[model samples]
Target: MRRDEFRKAFFDASDRVHTYAVWMIRNREDARDIAQEAFLRLWQRCETVATQSARAWLLRTVHRLCVDRIRQRTRRQEVSLSMLPIDSFVDADATTDWSPDGDLRGDVIRAVVALSPEDRAVVVLREVMGMSYGDMGEVLAQPVSTVKVRLHRARKRLRCRLEPLCEKRSVR
Candidate 1:
């Protein structure tokens, strides 16, 4: 990609790429680092990655980096809720009630965090990022059908985990 094209792509996709990284890694600093690294990689491969597909390329790169980071966290057994601020779980565009009495946000975050990295990625890409199945499949390197199945399974798992909490909150 040319300099001008690269600049345009950066302007257009930086927020989305950073958001995906944040949701995947659940650490702002780490997410920033991952986003930087992904953009750097894109720059390095500018000759190879077409400008039109830059966002998808960045997403795919970000996904791979997140998976590696998650694996490292797993091996070290160092994952912690303290590392992920509760505020990061809030969706700016979401219409869900944020009031204290109706807030199951913390429970939702916990449930999402408990998901395996692959499942979490599927959830973040589909539900949070609002990517279509074909786009998600490209990012995940899976078939579209597989992406749909994974998303369905992830949502079901989240529902199962959060249903009790929702019920409890409703009873009060």
Candidate 2:
């Protein structure tokens, strides 16, 4: 594809990419910055990345940028809740009534957030982005086998952490 075409592709995917970033990092402003930087990187490397899968390339770019930003920020000091912009979603009313235990949803979010970045990426890509393993592998630049292994481990950990919450709902 020509440079213009590549630019167009990046623009087309920008919204989804931004949403993915927000979902992964849980910061709207940071997500916007990540998406812009990813597209900028694509523009800079347009020639080399011309024939690569656009979706995968954009995702990988955004993911790498987010990771890098996280690492750089961590080097400065300890990470704490104060670092995250207060998200309005947390104040929103509960979405599900099925969790009679009264905090199952919050528990699930905490379990997910507790995961390491790599494991969290796997879970988010598979579950939230709805990417197939092959596409996820492309985005993650990992073999499908490795992606599957990571996904399995992530899900196992999530299940272990969430089981009590689920069981509590049943008991209630």
Q: What TM-score against the true fold does each predicted structure earn?
A: 0.89, 0.80
Q: What digit string (tens of lDDT, one per residue) describes model 1 on residues 33-121?
A: 99999999998899999888899999999999999998898899985554676656676577466643336777787788778888899
Q: List per-prediction Cα lDDT, in the order shown.
A: 0.86, 0.77
- lDDT (10s digit) by residue, model 2, range 1-172: 5686875796678877986787667676777899988888877887787555776899998899888877877798645453343232244564544242347656766677677778889988988689999999988999999999999999999999889888976898
Question: Global lDDT for candidate 2?
Answer: 0.77
Off by over 4 Å in 1: 91-96, 99-102
**Backbone clashes under 3 angstroms, per model:** 0, 0
Error of 1 at 70 (Å): 0.8
Q: Give the Å error, residue 152, model 2.
A: 0.2
Q: What is the C-alpha RMSD of each candidate to the true structure, in Å?
A: 2.2, 3.5
